[model samples]
Target: MMFEENPPSSYLTRAAHSEDSQETITAVSHVLQDQENTRPVPADNSKSFAASGDLPAKPISPQQRLARLRLLMSRQKAEYESKIASLEQRHRELQWEIRDTHWQLGQQRQRHRLAEMRIRDAERAKEDAERRNEMLQKEMEEFFETFGEINRWK
Candidate 1:
């Protein structure tokens, strides 16, 4: 009923006059076929349609197909570029973390060395203190023995 009112030729005529007519028509046909179960009118009726100052439906052109292919390639390129940038950023962050870890390890090694030195010094000081205590105990025993002998004589 809708085709009877506006006619299929009128749609093709408009499509033929557009810059990217073939692509537009194909897109419209696909949409119509999907949404309303409609089929594009064939080009075999061009003679009759032309006689009535209209055009007939034609297939998509090579130029239009190439344009769609180019568009798809560009989108894929953009997606890959985005992924590469993210990976590079992650790599940089990982490098910084590794550097920080190395620094911390160096600091810990230095602290361990200092603590070892302090422990060695403490051991030496304790040995010296023990030797002095032994000497003082011997001197006190000799003094007490001499005092006991003098008391016995008195």
Candidate 2:
């Protein structure tokens, strides 16, 4: 009686509402055989429940669920912030270590260059000392040549 009393506004919803009843399907089949026309109204979905998630399923509404799911794979809120901060700190430490290593490398290279120059200077000094010793030895031999004649005469 209530179904007969009130018909829904939309034709699609009205037809869909009718299809919920066995008598309506029979009537619709007979009407189709006789070549009749009918319109349906949108169905009420207040009592329906979604198969997944806490949100209701709609024709084209996903922004709400998507926003909630954006951080689904991420760490918890404050924990992620702390993790990022810690990672950045470690990166800064690594950068400082790299800088220190480069500086030490530069210092070692300078020492090597200076040592090479000193070695060359030392070689030259040693050669000059050897040359002076030979010149002194020849002068001493000339001085002893006169003494040898005096000793032979005595």
Best by TM-score: 1
lDDT of 1 by residue, 8-109 (tens): 344445666789866566744643334233446557775558665464476555565546535644665687688899999999999999999999999999
Worst 10 residues of 2 by lDDT: 1-10
Q: Give stretches of model 1 more than 4 Å off.
A: 1-59, 150-154
Return the lDDT, model 2, position 77: 42
- Using Cα atoms with residue i matched to residue i, what is each candidate's TM-score against the true structure? 0.53, 0.45
The Cα RMSD of model 1 versus the native structure comes to: 15.3
lDDT of each: 0.68, 0.57
User: Number of backbone collisions per candidate, in order?
Assistant: 0, 12
- Candidate 1: Cα lDDT at 107: 100
TM-score of 2: 0.45
Predictions: Cα RMSD each: 15.3, 20.0
On the 0 to 100 scale, the lDDT of residue 139 in model 1 is 89
